[model samples]
Target: MTMTSPVALTERQCTLIARALAEPRRYQILKEIAGQGGSVACACMQQKHEVTPATLSHHMKELENAGLIEIVREGKFATLVLKRETLDAYLRELASL
Candidate 1:
């Protein structure tokens, strides 16, 4: 059996994603992650945005909790992987509503 990253969803997660997408900056972060082939690190994103580490951390946590981005930690840094399929599914479900 091949192991793959988990992609579970709940009603709350869906709602969280919908709310997260409502913010333009958050949406930009999501798009940036997707554009980077589905993953980017906090440090890299901070460099891209030229924001303070504390501010970046807060935004990252919001994105992480929304399930729009997955965090893969390595030492003191984490790589954020865009959950593209999950995001697209959420959008499709919203459109159907």
Candidate 2:
């Protein structure tokens, strides 16, 4: 599959990305997802931060909306994975700016 460039993200998506990076814990969450060898479970993401489940859910939503993370549901379980290429492209865009 062809990967999408971060420059393709819309204004709303860019806002979501900025919001996600603004929170330290959310930033850590992204790191953890990247470090994980396999697809991370959404439930597992909660264990990485000290925040409440509600807050974790909110962060997940922001990351998803930002297109930085992709969620796939298998039966009752949801997996979260970092879109590293997209993230790299985003950082590259910022670097060029």
TM-scores for all candidates: the values are 0.82, 0.79
Where's the lowest-lDDT run of ten residues in candidate 2?
4-13
For model 1, residues 31-61, the per-residue Cα lDDT tens digits are 8998889988778888888778887777778
Q: What C-alpha lDDT does candidate 2 achieve relative to the native structure? A: 0.79
- At residue 85, candidate 2 shows an lDDT of 66
Q: Model 1, residue 67: displacement in angstroms?
A: 0.8
Best by TM-score: 1
Model 1 global lDDT (CA atoms, 0 to 1) = 0.82
- Residue 27 displacement in candidate 2 (angstroms): 0.4
TM-score of 1: 0.82
Model 2 Cα displacement at 71 (Å)?
1.2
Q: On a 0 to 100 scale, what is the lDDT of residue 65 in model 2? A: 79
Instruction: Give, for candidate 1, the lowest lDDT window spanning 10 residues.
Output: 4-13
Return model 1's CA RMSD, one decimal. Answer: 3.0
